[model samples]
Target: MKIFKITGEFFLAVLKRTAFSFLDLMKIIVPVYTMMTILSYTPVIKFLADWLKPAMKIFGLPGESALALILGNFINLYAAIGVMPLLHLTPWQTTTIALMLLTSHSQLLETSVFFKLKTRAIFLLILRLSVAIMVGLLLALR
Candidate 1:
């Protein structure tokens, strides 16, 4: 009976922690997704698309793909994925974007983690961003 009580308490604690973590993630994802969706319907997206077109061309991606990159970097990969289909990306473009995000997604959250661990947050941020850009450019060459 004591063992059963301990097991039940442990499971309950795990469940509660998981739920809180999910809510924390949702707080970031939902707002970013909502803003991206709203931006898709406005001229702001077009302006950003046009502004980023030249840089995106270097990565063989459409200008609109900038939103995914921004969201993936600042928010999370899920936020990037939420915005991807709206851009109508080609397979290669999608692959390039995925690679970039995989290399350096969730900048703010990850940076905080680095800081908590007594690591150099800015150095890691720069390194990750640089590596992501280089990998993206190389993938574009293929």
Candidate 2:
């Protein structure tokens, strides 16, 4: 009976924490998703896409996947992932972006931590960003 009560309490706590996490993600995902959808209907998206295409071609990604890379680096990975579905990424493209972001996501947050550590944040930022790009290009070439 005691074990059963403990298990029940554990499940309840997990459920509560999970609900809050889901809500937090919804806050980021919903707004980004909505903004992307609205932009998709405008010439703004096409313009942005056209402008980015040359650079994004280096990673074999569609121009709009640039949004995901930017968001992941500056904001967080969740915000980036939110836009990917609308981008219609190929499996290879998705893998490239995922690899890139894995190396360099949440740059602002990490840079602040480096500052707090009295470390050279700019050097670290350059290193991470360059490594991400190199990894992306390597995968894109495969």
Q: Model 2, clash count?
A: 0
- Could you say which candidate leads in lDDT? 2
User: RMSD in angstroms, all models?
Assistant: 3.4, 1.3
TM-score of 1: 0.76
What TM-score goes with each of the models? 0.76, 0.93
For candidate 2, the TM-score is 0.93
lDDT of 2 by residue, 1-35 (tens): 89999999999999999999999988999999999
Badly placed stretches (over 4 Å) of model 2 are none
Error of 2 at 8 (Å): 0.9
